[model samples]
Target: MTAKEGVATGSVPSATPTEVADLARVEDRISFLYFERCSVSQADNSITVTDDRGTIRIPAATLSVLLLGPGTKISHKAMVAIGENGSTVVWVGERGVRMYAAGRPLTHSSSLLQRQAALVSNRRSRLAVARAMYQMRFPGEDTGGLTMQQLRGREGARIRNVYRRLSKETGVAWDRRAYDPDAYEDGTEINKALSAAHTCLYGVVHAVIVALGCSPGLGFVHTGHERSFVYDIADLYKAELSIPVAFRTVAEEPVDIGSAVRHAMRNVLYDFSLMDRAVRDIKALLNDDGMADLGGPEENHVGLWDEKVGEVAAGRQYGPDDGE
Candidate 1:
């Protein structure tokens, strides 16, 4: 039977997402998937993608993020199987810009998410997590004496020094780090390199966050944006991985400069084992046992002030009278 037929005919049951269980580590899944001009459907226990070139099979269980780009048609059968495998599917345009939609979490357990929310909600916990993140970036430095403001100042200066040093080393004239996302294609080679590097970092970080069943919105340093936590974590690796790769890309100045920078970023990610590193970093950040109580019923963690924004989402007070 064809893969789609096999899945749809009920000859084989596609496992529910929660039933598959989370992978032991984030790196165990396909970190990123960008599909263009292809039709995706189910085949037996896997997903098959077909384009003008040919057909390829992806083990659905190993998928982390699937970026459905332009000219991509996905069958419901395929979507069902993909969702069951716990893959986050994103619909995007060419060059992977303009994301339209993405999948929800496949997990029933809220332990990791509760820890994230607890850390984000309390001032002390928030600052502690933020410091922990910064400590990861700096490494070996005792930051106990540094206040939040001072830590931010030091981080800014450190990044400036990085830009200046890399500029001097690679002869890439970089005065200030600036990129207008609205006018993305209009930027210079360095700016494009920087943009490319950031997006790549964002993608991988997003995957790790989703894979580990963490809410990308519960950010320590940043807030508001859906992937605020992703941006927060990506900042840890920016100076070490993305910025240098951008500078090196400008130094070489390949014909397809954007492509070259992305290629370089991929090389660095692989060489440094960022997938595994990200998983480890996330585990370390949220491993606090104190957060277990926070994952309980809404009444236990809920308070009178209505401080917990997520409480509304918990369906306790989400009546039809309440504006959604």
Candidate 2:
């Protein structure tokens, strides 16, 4: 790509591999953002999100995910800035149901992802990882002798049990896992609650997946879909996070149930410290070395984590030069 094309497309300028690799593990940004009923415009080397309330200047580089909900418009330049920052831009429906996602491809370096690909490529290794995932999901539940079919059946039973328990708690009927992404207007309260909760979880997982340089499509439990690995990791925490949040939100039965669920999901996600837990859990789920593998090769990361380096970078205010 030409330099001009690179600039227009938000390509890295004079960026070294070590720098890119260092950025891959950062967790300082807000985990999620949403834009609707406004225009996202490129202004003065930053993206300005304008709505009825006023204008909010976004340092896109410092955000994990930007959700473009309904009634949103964005400029080409704004898109470029977002991609350059390596932040994900997702077009979503009511309560964060993903419609489309923008932003850059996997850019980080991690030995864990290399190991993950190797395991996924082999039949025995892949199944072992799947079993590991199952074990991680249900702690203290021995599944060493169970086949894949049995594991799936157990997962189904566990989900049904969660629903039944929550149904009793909140009086919201969960006939089955049901929600139409295309028909958001008709989704039942329980279904909407499930979608809201999962959408938040998905955003956090996606950020970590991209940050760790792992392919979201690579999966053991959930196969297929662009967010297969996203689903697999999210399922680990779904029962504990989403189910109760959904039930409680539905029990309120507010006039604007969708909005209420969305608000509640975000609150619980932050209050419960889901982002940090997600990063830690994903590493353990995928590799024995866990968080250690996330930093990549030791030689490549001499002073990346030094406090002085962090203080300098942190002191530099966010602006047009953030990606630089």
- Model 2, range 1-324, lDDT digits (tens) per residue? 111222322463321112333333336666777667899975443568998899988665566777777899998667766665667777777667765665553353455676778888899888988898889778888998899999999998998899999898878777887778888668887787778777766876787677656788888777878888888888888888888888899888888766776678778877877767876776676664734444345423322334555423233456678663
Best by lDDT: 1
**TM-score versus the correct structure, for each prediction:** 0.78, 0.79
lDDT tens digits, residues 122-153, model 1? 99878888899888878889887689898999
Poorly placed runs, candidate 2 (over 4 Å): 1-26, 43-46, 105-107, 288-324
Clash count list over all predictions: 1, 0
| Model 1 poorest 10 in a row by lDDT | 292-301
Residue runs of model 1 more than 4 Å from their true location after superposition? 1-18, 22-24, 97-101, 104-107, 289-324
Model 2 TM-score, 2 decimals: 0.79
Alpha-carbon shift of residue 39 in model 2 (angstroms): 1.4
Sliding window of 10 residues with minimal summed lDDT for model 2: 1-10
Error of 2 at 68 (Å): 1.0
TM-score of 1: 0.78
